[model samples]
Structure formats: structure tokens, C-alpha cells
Target: MLESLWAEMPDRFRTIDLESNALDTDDLTAFLTDPRGPGFRIRFGQLPADMDREMAWCCWRIAELGGRVPVGVLRSLIRWLAATVEDHPELSGSLMRAAPREWERSIAAAYARRNGSLPGRFWQENVGSTLRRCYEILWAAYDQRPWWRREVWDPTLDPRIPLRPHEPLGNHAVYFQQLEPLWLRIAIQWYFKVSLETGQLTWSTVAGPQRTALQVFADWIAGHDPVPPPWLREDPAGIRAFMLDFLSHVRGLITQSGPNKGKPLSPQRVNTLVTCLETFYAFMTDHRETAAQVLDEAGWLRLGPYHAMLWRHGEKGRRTRVVRERRQEVIDDTAFSQIMSNVHLLGEPIEGGGLGDEQIMRILMLVARTGRRISEIRMLDREPLLPLDRLCGSTGPADADGAFVAKLRYQQTKIEQAPDTVLVDAEIVAIIDEQRRWADQHLGPRWAQGVTPKYLFLGHNMNRNADKPFPPSRINQTLAVFARRLDVRDSAGRLVDFNRTHRFRHTKATSLLNAGVPLHVVQRYMGHVSPTMTMEYAETLAETHQREFLRYHKVTADGRDLPVDTRDLYDMLELDKRTDRILPNGWCLLPPRQACDKGNACLTCDKFATDASFLPELKTQQHHTLQLIDERRQAFAARTGQEMSPDNVWLAGRTQEHDALGRIIDTLEQTGHRTDSDGRAVRGAGVAARTDALAAEHDEERRP
Candidate 1:
């Protein structure tokens, strides 16, 4: 059998270069000598007829002389012998029987070497587990079974056998379990594959929480004895009840890990689990025609009812759910200044007390200036930077001193509709240039050879894989370490948390909006698909609103001075408390739940409050109202030959508003507030100078 298996090997292995050939005797010989070395291993040559038997006998001898062989040497020898006969089942069986005792001794010896003591009861129980895996690998190869196929779950199996508890069940192990319907199992696996291909889901996402939901659901069904599997074709009612019960149990159950262990899941987490389960049911129902062919109409109906229950439960649960509103955290001006002042000290020798890389500082700066997502920054391709001339036609920041600006292009993964290009500062472009030179020098010849992807932020570690993009976690880790070294703290006096790199994004967006950039412009800068998302990042600061109110209230559209103090104007309109209710012409102070009784007669209503800010709008309304009053008077005269008539009662109200608006406008003009050429309110020359002095005082007061 060994000879036949060897003979069946491809002819390419017979060559010296394994990359260009198949494995042969010479390759096997070289592999055994030094498996981790540079060159390809040599294959084995012709063997004696009793080779399998001889290997088995040698294994038995090693078991008897346990302490004679060092643990490491014994492990290597067993592995080498196992690989040699892995394709020969008869030989594998013989060696499996001989190696059990030897395997135990080797495992114990290896444990003692690491911990300086023998493993206790739990380790002892799992002693043969590694040896079992070796035998299983050989058996699996001989049987030609899929690599993921493994032993089915055994309820009585010792949970402690695997030393490491809480290990999730494998895909094959979960699918082969007898409790779940075969068709349902197949459908889920198929969905997982499709999702992975479309980038709609990740393997880790499906393997972790999705699998856990299914396992917990199955366990619940099992615990209820003799209840036909909840997924059974005849049990629509049972399935619906089981789903509701499962959700309730999940909601109330406390977590067993992380900082929040022993506390019930948050609304967000509960919602996530609900979504996961709902997705599974949705997939089944979406392909109902196919599923019915396999499980029949009864089984298909079971899925529909359960899906409906999940939808209704989610809707009702959300009504009463108290989802905590989380404020977007950002690095304030003080923290940003401090970070920039000390950032250059990172990545120095340990003697200088440096504990981070300079590369992270560059990344943070890029995020601050560009407001790009961390992932988008991380996955930037080899050549991301462009010259200002290349982007002459592109929308970007204005040029300064005729100097070249930098534009970066990168894919936006989160919001797919967002644009992929952004304007960056020349300083950031210099940083990228420096990184490119460094990568070329340090990343071997791959940069020059053009054989590998030239990631701008390549990993520097030599022990692990190289020439790959740096992990986002490493960037965050560097920030955390640097933050600790500086002892950074927030306003609350707690140590500043640097875990969220997204704070830089929020900080950038807020800064741009507060600097007077229009909302639509800021939206484009931040790569937001909608203005709403941009607004979330541009949450207005109290200081910003204060400054705007002070600036606007001191002038009128026609360049006249205002008679009222801005604070009194704000008070009259209740503007500070209800900013949204203030209109250009007047303020509406009515309660939100109440209806307006005066309708369009705002100027005539006592609830209305107007100042110089309303002069232009009031003038416009007065002109229109006066024109309508004249038309109504003419109609009344034409019909009744009277200047006033009951038919003109509506006109009487309009006349009152027209007169009231005219009086308000005259008062604003007398106080020196008037419109300019552009129709925007401006303060008179004397008032403008006084307003400037007051603004300077306000600025001085706000300074640190």
C-alpha cells in the first residue's frame, strides 16, 4: 500500500525544486532533517517491505523507554513517522495502537517543561486528545473525508476534556448533530457561504454569534424532553412559542464574560441577537419554494409562523425599549495640542522612555485632517497620494501660496455611496512620501521587484509575516500606550480613553462646521452619504450658538442699529430653550402640543416677538398684506358702494397686521438697524465699531 501510494504521487514531486515539482523520496528526507529551514524538503525513496511494521515496533519500544527520549525529540519523531504512513490506513492503525502510551509520556514531559510541574486532573483527562487528533488526521486523509468533518457532539462527553473550556462547536460538528432538521442545517450553511462571497458577512461573524444563537436554541429544545424538535414539519405552534421563549431567556440572561459580566445584555446587544435569529428565519422563508421541495409544505409553514412571531416581538419590544443615547466623544482642542506637542517623541529607544511608533501619530493626524474612517486609512493602496495638478478639476480646498496640495484616493467601505477622494494637507503628503521610502529600504526587494503589494503602512515585525498592511489594532494600541505615558485626562478628570480612533473623525467634522463651512460642503469632506450623518458629527457647541446670536442681533439687514439687547431678544423668543421655533419674521412661543389660533396674523398676535433681525421679513409681509387689503376694499366698494363692509372683515384683520408690521419696521430704522445692498442686516458705522469691541471682549473672556 505504501509503494502504491508513493507511485501514485505526481511526477513534479520527483524534481529538486518543490515549487516546480511534486514531493518525492529526497523531499521527505530533507523535510525530516529541518522542516522550518529555507529549502524545500526531499521526498522518501523506496522502503523495505516491513517499513510500517518496523515503525510500529519502534513506537512500542519508545513507549517502554519513556524517560530516555527528551519530550521535544519524541514529539518530532512521532510526527515524522505519522506523516510517512498517513495515507496507509493499515500502517496508521498499527502505529496508533503502539503510540498511545508513548504519547501520554511525551505530553506529560512537555507540560512539566513549560509549567515546571505535572498537569493536574483536568489536564490528565485530556492527555490523549492531541494524540487522538494525530490519529484522526491520518484516518481522515485515508478516508478522503472533508477536512472540517469531525466527531459528533456527545452529551456525556467530558466538558473538561479539552482543558480550554467554552470552545465553540465546529461547522461540521454542528451540522451533523441529530437534533436540527437536515434541510434547515443545509440551508444555513448555504446562506453562510453566499454571504461570505458577497462581503455581506465575515466568517468570524457567522462562526461566533450566529453559531452560538443556533446552539443555544438547540439546547433549549433538547432540555424540553419529548417535544418534537421545534423545527419539525408538524410543529408550527411549538416553533413560534420556542422562538419567543428563547428571546425572553436571552434578554434576561446575564453575560458570562467581559467587563459587563453578570449583567443583563444592553438593548443594543439584545437587538443584535434578535437580528441574528431573524436573519436565519428570513433566509429560509426567502427561499421558501426550494425549502418546501425538501421539507414539504408543513415544514415551510413552520418557518413562516416563526418569522412572523419574531417580527411582531421585535416591533413591540422596541416600543418600550430604552435605548441609551450615546454622545459622540471627541478630542478637544487642549488634548489635541498636547498630543501634537509630544507626538515626535514616540518610537525612540527605550532609554528615552518611548513606548510607541511614530507611524501611529501620522495616522491620527491624517484622520484629524481628512475625517476618514480608520479602516479606510488602514487599507489605502500602495500609491494613494496625488499631486495638486492631477486633481485640478476635482473639488477640493483652495490653494495657498500657489503651493501644491495633496489629494488621497481610497475606498469607502462603510457608506458605499460616499466619494473615495479627499484633499489632504501637504504635510500629510510628506509623511506618506517618507513612509514609501522607508518601506522600499526595509521591506527587502519586494518594493523594487514589484512582486508584492506595497502597503504604505507595512508591519515592521520580523518574526511574523511581513510585507502586509499594518493592522488597525496596532495603531490603536500605540495610541493607548502613548496616552498613558502622557497621563491624558478628560474634563471629568478620568484618564482619557484612546480606544476609539473615531473620535478624530468627529473632532475634524465638528471643527470644520464650527469654522463656518456649509453643511453640504462638510458632508462631502467627511465622505458622508447623507447630510444627516454629517450633522451627527457636527453637533453644535454652545459657544458657537452664543457667538452667532451676538453677531446677528447687533445689526439689521438695512445697516441700522438694534434697540434691544441680544440676550433680551433671546429671552423674548425663548430662543435659548427652543431654537427651532424661531422664524425670521418673529418667534412662536406656543407650546409644541398646542395649535396656532392667530394663523397668519403673526404681527398682530401678542405671542409674537420681533427685533431688528426681523425687519426685512416684516417689511416683505407688510407689503403683501397692504396689497391684499387694497384689493378687498375695491371689491367691497364695487358691490356695496361702501369703504367698509361686513364682507371685508377678513381684510380688516390683514389691515391691522399691515399697520403693526409698518410700525415695527419704523421703530427698527429709528434705532439704526437697516438693510444693506445684499439685503443682509448690518450695524450702523458707530454701532459696528462698538459691536467689534464687544466681540473682542467676548473672545478674550473665552481664551484659556
Candidate 2:
């Protein structure tokens, strides 16, 4: 059997190159030397007459000896051996039995070596620490049978949440006592995959996203919101009734707003939500379908209607499109700029009490400039953003890789390339230097009361380890917000602003894009896996809005030199110049401002809303412009495939500008002087009035 098995094995493995492949070459030799290879040990050529038995015996022997070879390597060997020796069930079982223990030990060892200590491995050294708590997860140590649990009510429903002991709560209690550590580990692992893949360390994986969503859910539970799952019921009345009762308890933690004070559910949080929902839907669908098939054969829908009612629909039938329309005001550039200006940086005082504004600004600027995500930054070692010369190959700052590894070596970030890069613009470098000087002045060893944390930024409190860096969370928590408490108010004296440290980082990326940088370049600057990930910035273009309006309009030095494509590029503008929507009796769309310099009076000017019908035949040429827009949208979507949310109905159309076009139209309508009547030609007016109105209307409608 052994001879036949070896003969049947793929030729590639027969002459395996352990050195070339992702395998431990030395370890392979160690396994070959172990008793498992041949018990008493024999050359490969001189192997036993019964090679199959010899192989099985070798694996068992390794287990018996507590194999020196890594479990992963051993497992790999076993797979190769199993495939080669087809009739080796007993040997495979032994390898499987011992594989996990070895796997865990191997990872643990990596962390320990990297961190310089086992405990350091758990606290700060690597990405593994973020997920070190996951080591607590013992899959087999489940105390109870697998049970389906749902979100349960929490009695702490005041506007202010009350603290509770770990012993009591809802369904979370069991998880808290038995699985908290394990869940944390799982979250860490999940964060690891997503962060690495995204090219930006973020809690975008299910484990991390779920943690945030869970907190939001918990908050809702505490607040007593009761919105039922929409898919649970089909009838509008029933759904609404359930929603009304459940809305207070619905618990909305919309991460679309970005994370709050604590760690945010990564943007991948939505991806996780969809994936989990899809999985659940799949399982439930299959189960229900099978049950229904059985029930239908048995005439169950009528005879046992209750059974049918529980599932609501058949498996495939349950796949319904949810068309939820959102109503959000378009954020014009003026508003966006104001919001950003009001954002407090490191220098500003924390008006209501918080970290200094400049400090918060610096943090946000670093995070945003390098596209370092908020969560990733929280897990980072506090340090000044410095030139590469200062980062590595020098004693001034800890070596870049070494410092990052020690501070934020997460499983997700366990690579040569760190998600957070510390490149500083010349201006920002000046800011950082200023901050360091201030720190040296006020937080120096003599002025301060206790041993200061080694981190570049720190709170008043001393760090747990005087030698180690400050806790990422403690410093960030105190410094993340100052402007939010001070700024963001409406004329009515209500808070209309939503500010957070990460928001600045997000805004920085947005500003870069708006300043006319290429999407792909901006995506890279932000360290996003793809340009699409960067689209989540609030500056996303709507269907009616040109998110890159300035870029499109401004002729760059290169653009000016490039050969003009008069045929395709200017087709729309050309068409707009020749005609109007309909001829307006009053004036042309383009209004002259020869008399007055400032265009303020243009709002009440006489020529704003003229009818376009008077234009000879301009509207007929609109097809060209619309075509360009369509093409642009497709190109955008294709480039950033996942950038626009699938749920964004307007996003489905050409250009995000189109999505918020209503506002643009409002701007047109409110401008200049038009009759109080519907948008039309100002009939019977003098020739000047008619011409002026017509020109202004045409220009406004045609402005891209």
C-alpha cells in the first residue's frame, strides 16, 4: 500500500523544494530525522516494505515524543503524507489531534520573541497584543450547549447609563464570564486580516465591527429602543407597529458618522454586518426551504399556518430589496470649510475642558496626513511625526520599524510595512517641533509631578510603566475633543456640529481630494486598500454635485499644455452656449455684470430665471453632456468598485453630484429676479428684461 501510495502522489511533492516553498526547511529535516519518519530512523531510499504503515507509525511516534517540530510544519507534512499514502486514516487523526496545540504555541512564541517578554507580548509590542486576549478563547471549553441568543433588555435605560457589575446583565452576561476573553481574541484576529488587507490598520473586520455595533446595540438596549428587525415582518402596518414599539429600543449605532469617543466600528463594519446577515439569511433560508418543502408536501401552510408564519416567507422568497431613502442636506464647500476651520487643533484651549485644541489638531493632522486610521492610531505608540531620517537608522527616535513593532505590532499590522506612516509636510514638521518644545517645557521631568510616559503625547497622569510608552487610549481620550465642546453652534444656540479627532483626519483626506489630487493617489496617501475606501469621507460627491468641481474646472499647467480634445471634451459647453432649455422671452442664460462688480445683486437681478424655449435649438444638443456624465460615473464606479455604498440609490446614477442636485437647482431658482410664477419666460417685458432673463437662466442651467 505504501509503495502504491508513493507512486500515486503528485510528482511535484516527490521532489519537494522546502527551501523555495513557504516551509521550514530545517524543520522538515528534523521531522525526517524523528522516529515518525521511520521509527528507528532510515534513509528515504531505504524506507520500509510497508511504507504506509511506516508513515502512520512515524506520526504517532512524533505525538508520543511531544514533537519538536512546529505543529504547522508537522501538519503540512502530515497532509503531504496523507495524500501520498491514501490508506492512512489513523495517522491523519493523530496529526489533527495535536495540530492546534502546536499552532497556538507557535504563535505565542513569535509574539514573545518579538516583544522581548511574554507579558510585553500581551500588552504593547505587537498587533498580537490587541488580540492577545483572544488566547483566552478555548473553543472546546464551551460551558453550555450551543444556544440561539437574541439581544435582550438592559434595565439601565436612563439618558445616563448606569454602571453595572460584571456578574449581571442580559444575554451578554454568559459571554462576559465565559467568552469575553475569547471574543476579544477573535476580534483581534479579525482586525488583523482586515487591517492588513485594507493596507490601513482599521477595525474593519467582523470581530472589531461587531464589538462597536454591539456597544451601539448595548446603548440602545440601555436606552430601551425597540425597533424590530425590518425583515422580520412583511406587512407595512405590522412592520410600522413593531417599529414604533421597538424604535426606542432599536439601538442605532450608525457608524456612518465615524467612531465616537472610543474605538469605532471600522468601515468594514458594514461589510461585516452584510456578511453576517447574508450567512444567517443563507442558513435560515436553506433550513426554511427544506422545512417548507416538507410542509408543502404535507399541506402545512394551511393546516399548520403557524409554522409558515414564523419564517414569513420561503427561502428564496425572503430575498427582498430594501429601498430606504435617506434625506440629508448637501454640504456645500462654504459649510464644509467653516466646519473644518472651527475644528480645534493642538493650540486651541479646550473651552469646556478637554485637551488643548492644538494638541487635538496635531493628533488629527498626523492621523489624516498619513491616512493612519483612528483605531490604528489608538493602538500606535505615541510619537511625533518626523522625517524618515529621524525615524530609522538613528538613536534620536526609536528605529521606525522597531518603534512601530513595539508600540502597534497587531496581528493585522504584523508586517514589514506599517499602516501608519509618519511623513510630515514642512509646515506640519514645524508644528510638531513646536509641540515637542512645549512638552519639554511644561511636561519636563522637573515640572511634572510623576514619571512621565515615554509617549510623544501624554495626559497628566503617569503611565503604568515609567519606562514604557503611555497607554494609547488614555492620551487619545483626553486629547481627541476640544473644538466639539466649544464650536459647532447654530443661530438658535444648539449644537449642530459633530467633531472627533478622526474627523479631522478624514477631513484632511477630503480636502486633498477636493484640492484636485487624483483619486488613486489620494487613496494611497490615505493608505486605503483601494480608492473606494477613501470615498467614505463626508466629501463624497453626490449625483448632482461635482465632488471634484474645482479639479474639473481648473486648468492645471499640464492640462494647459495638453492638446485639446475639442470634439468630445467641450461638446456640452458648446451645446449650452448655442441654446437654452426653452426659449425664455426675457433674456439669455448668461447675464452680464458690466455695471456692478460684486455679483451679490445677481440673486435679485432681473435676468436669473428666463425661459429657454426662445433659444433656437440648444436643448437638442444636451445628449452630449449627459453622455459625458454617464461615462464619468461608470468610470468612477469601475475605478472604486466598492466606494459608493450599494444602497446609495443616487450613487447608482452618474456622478455623486447628481444625488444632491436638488440643492443646486434651489440655488439657481433663488438667484436673480424671476416672476413669482413658475419657472418660465418673463413675458411682455421690455426687450432688455427679456434678453437679460434669458441669458442668466441659460448660463445657470448650463454651468457644469
Candidate 3:
């Protein structure tokens, strides 16, 4: 790596001599006069006599560590390094010894001296980028410890994501050095234990907010007037006192950075701060012996039951509050239509107020059509589309034509055991195919062999091997700007906020349920680990429910069309919220204040009502009822050598139920609600006939 950087330098600059601590004056003169070096000597004269050699070394090291650097940036880097060592000699002798804060001050002072104030753009382009590159190299070289043992863990090097190095380190690096020494030690060991030893979490989660939470706790501890001790290892009284003070301290704190700066910390933020401490203490207490041995301190054994438990029942209610406050809005049909119609604007040039992204529109299309999580879609493997027959070893379910169906095995980034593969229609497959072609055309040569790129969507910068998936934050930011520019709004005139891509997941799930798809099927489609989690997305719209309810004629006990107004019946039943009113085969139409005196004989009750949505349940119940009647009649005949009387009480009830079920089924079949075993509508002539009837009815309604 250094060879490429040293190619343009003279022989003396090619290698650092092990015996010489500093470059000789002649060597420095050769470098400054070299045609390839920064072609100016104005700043060179200001360099400190004792530290100029070290400053020159930084310039060499940065070039060696980073990609091609501009001469201007190299000049700025030299100036920054020289000024830093002159002003803060103790912090600047070597990049390896410099701390984050020291480097921070060095850059600020250097830029301030030259420009009066540091500008964000110039700082990033010149000083920040150059320093980060040099420091990254220095840290990699200085820290010879195993990753788990180091103060900073770079998740980009993790084998699970082989191309993480192609992405920026700021997003993936976890710094434990900011913590107090003791807490740092505990945190390092705990992170190692959970993330590597036990495999409790993947780095995606452990390296993110969890790491930030720990750092926040560390900062709080460092800010205490008198340094705080390990109260978790202290006696019960000390533990209690420490926790009370910590909680109060955390609650009263305000945000110090980002969009929420100067505002009070949210309840969610407070919970995270407290929860991290609790998690840390709980882990230490559970594995006290291991922690003690690892930290080389017997004090860890003092962790007790008091340390193991932190908050009492109901104490951490902010999580519940967060759930309660969460707005899972489904992008309504009008909004969805508006977005899709103008989706081409997303790929338009940025000068035209668009994202100039080629992949985002396709990505959003996949998410909407498949109901997949954005991460799952973004991290899709290159060959995500598998033949349905290959995945299941047979043709798919009868309703799905296998040739037009494919299994999309997305990267399961969140829940471990959740379904990773979902059966997708040809429409979704076409989108994936389009993206795959784009990746292949763009990234084929980047792969060493004929192998495909690892991810369907590749990162924009430094992704030579196509290892890193496109950044998720890019999608969010682009979506936000797009929505604002397009002024996309719903039917109610509220802005359709598409920034949270998860809302597409919610929208898809809700749409499926309202379209009469079964809950368990939706659960599998949405990759939900539990039906309850899937339920969270099941916000059924009343208009959809009413439309579906009114689509088919409802029949009563004797197979006659119900006389009541369907809209009034819908309101009277409160079908959306009242699950008790919803029965297996049909809805029980008894008023909320009225008792059902008819008991289980709902089929015989005049108040029972149902339509096409209940056709599947009705068919199953009718089949089962017929089986029972036949079995009982056969048993009576076998015992007495005579057929059971139709008037017998048990026989009469069975006949009535079987007859009632038969009548309901016949009525539904007549109205064209007949379906296959899978509940999919019979799709040939019956569908065309119903379509024509619906059109005619729609025309009549329009006229009236």
C-alpha cells in the first residue's frame, strides 16, 4: 500500500529508517524541492525546528494511508500538523499518541488562525478527512491487540460483512476510550462477551445506539464533580443512592447536539441512558466470575442481587409510552398513487431538485410491492430471486403459477428467527431483476472473478468490490427532500411522510388485511416473528372495510337477503373494533346491549348475517357439520338396525344446522362468492360476470 504512495517520492522519502528518529535536513530539503511535493515554502519556514520532521512524517503517512490526495489538502494537512505540535506539543508528537479531543483542538486552532473561523465544508474536505485517514492508519498500526481486546472496535473488519471497509468508518467504529478507565474495561469485556462470545446480538445493533448509550453513560460519569466509583460493586445502600442520583441526573439533562440540541432529553433517551447501565450491571452480576478474571480484579465479585436488578415494575414506562405514541400511518391509496406517478423525478438530476439516484426508486418499489423491511430490501443478495419450485421442491401453492412466482430470500437484519424468504409475484421479481441487471452492468468488472456483487444495491463511494450495501440513511434523507419538493400529500391534505420507509411496510400490511388476506398469511409476508407484531401494523381503514362489506350481498338464517341498510348495520355492529361481534362463520348481529339467547345455534338465529368475506369459514363449517350428521346417523343405525327419526331432538338440531349451513353456502355460491380451498376467488367467468355487474351497479349509483 505504501509503495504506491512512495512511487512519486525520492529514495530517502520511500522508507523510514529504523535507526533514525527524525529525517536529516538534506532529506527535508529534497522533499520540499521535489516536483511532486506541495509546491510552496511559505508555511515551511514557520515549522517548529524540533517537530518539523514528525510533521513531515504525518504528511507521508496520510498519503500512504488514504486514496489519491490533492496537493492543496496535503499543504493544509502539513500546516495543521505543524500548528498542532507547536501549540500542544504533549498531544502532537505522534498520531498514535493523539486523542480524539486533542486532534479536535489541533484542527480548530489551525483553521481559526488562518481563517478566523473554521468553515464546515473546508474543515471536512481538507483537515478532517486528512487527519482521520492518517489516524486510522496510525491506530491500525499501533493497536496490535485482537479486535475484542482493543479500545476501539471497527465493525467494518467483521467477517460477516466482508466489504464493510468499503464504507465510511464513522458509521461503523465504536470508541470505548472516551469512558473512565474502569468502566471502559467493563464495557470492552461486556461487549466482547455478548457480541462475540455468546452471539447475543449482531454488530449492526451492538455497534449503534447501544454503543452510543454506553458512551453517554461514560460521559455522565466523567462529568461528576468528584469521580464516581464502581457503585454497582458496593453495598446495597451505596447502589441505591448511586442509582437515585443517576436517574435524577439523567432526567434533568438536555440534548447537547444534533437536531434536538438545547431541548430536554426525551423519555426514550432517558430510558436508554438508564437501561444501558442496568444492562451493564446485569451482565456483570450474571457473569461476575468471568468478568473478574477478565478484568483481573476481584472487586467484580462484589456484584450482587442489588446490582442485577435496576428498575422496578412499571418504572421504565417510557418504552410503553413510545409504543403508545408511535404513529403507524399507512400511506393512503391517493398518496401512494401520487408518489408512484412522480417516482421518475427521484432519478432526475439534483440540479432539478431531485436526488439524482438511480437505485432509490427501484428500492422503494420493491419495499412497497413485497412488504419487506427496507434493510431487507437494501441488503438483498445479488441472486435473491430463486425459482419457487427450487425453494419448496415442488410447484407453489395452487393459486400461484410457479413460473410467475419466485422466492425472495432477503437479508434478515433484525429478528434472528423471523422468516427470511417470502414468496413474491412476478411484479416484484421484475423489479429485483431490473436492479440485478443494473448492478451487473455497473459492477461486474469490480469483482475479481466472474462472481456477482455481494449486494443488490451497492454503495456510491469507495465500493470497489461492491461489498457494502447502499447506505440506508441516504434513502431516508432523499425521501425527505423528495417529499418536500414534490409536496406529496394525502387525500386529507396532510403531507405524506415517506422518510420512515417502515411506513411502507405498515401500508402494505394494512392493505393486505383490508383486501381480506388472512392474518397468518400477512404475518409470513411481512416477515413478522409473531402474529402480535403483525397485528401492530393491522390498522384496518373503515372505508375499505365498508366497501368490502358492501361488495357482496348478506344473507340471513333462511338464505334471504337481509332487509337492513348495510351502512347502518356496519355502524350498529362497530365491526372494526368489536371482535366479539365477529363470529367464525359470520357476524352475530345481536345488539351490544342484547344477550344472545340462542347460544351456539347462531346459524339458526334470524339475527346472524354474513357475506362473501366469511365464505371460507362457512364452507369449512358446513363440511364439518355434514360429517357429524353422517357419523351420528350411521352409529344409530348400527346400534338399533333402524335409521334415526328426523324428529328426534338431537337429530332435529343436527338437521337444522346442516340445512342452515347448506342454505347459506348455496346463497353465497349463487352471488358468486364461491372460492377454492385457498380462499382465492374462482377467477374465470365468475370474476368477469361479477366485474360486469359491479360496473353496472356503479353506473346506476353515479346516475342517481
- Candidate number of the best lDDT: 3
Error of 2 at 615 (Å): 22
lDDT of 3 by residue, 570-675 (tens): 6776744476566877777677778778778777777777777777888888789889889999999999999999898988876788777777777778876432
What TM-score does each of the candidates earn?
0.56, 0.35, 0.64
Tens-place lDDT per residue, model 1, 510-579, is 7887788898988888887888777665544433454345444333322344445565655554444565
Rank order by lDDT, top first?
A: 3, 1, 2
- RMSD per prediction, one decimal? 17.0, 25.0, 14.8
lDDT per residue, candidate 2, 317-358, as tens digits?
333322111012223344445555754544555584435645
Question: Which candidate tops TM-score?
Answer: 3
Candidate 2, residue 470: how far the Cα is off, in Å: 6.4
Off by over 4 Å in 3: 1-94, 97-124, 157-171, 188-194, 223-225, 232-234, 253-272, 318-328, 351-353, 390-403, 440-452, 539-704
lDDT of each: 0.54, 0.36, 0.66
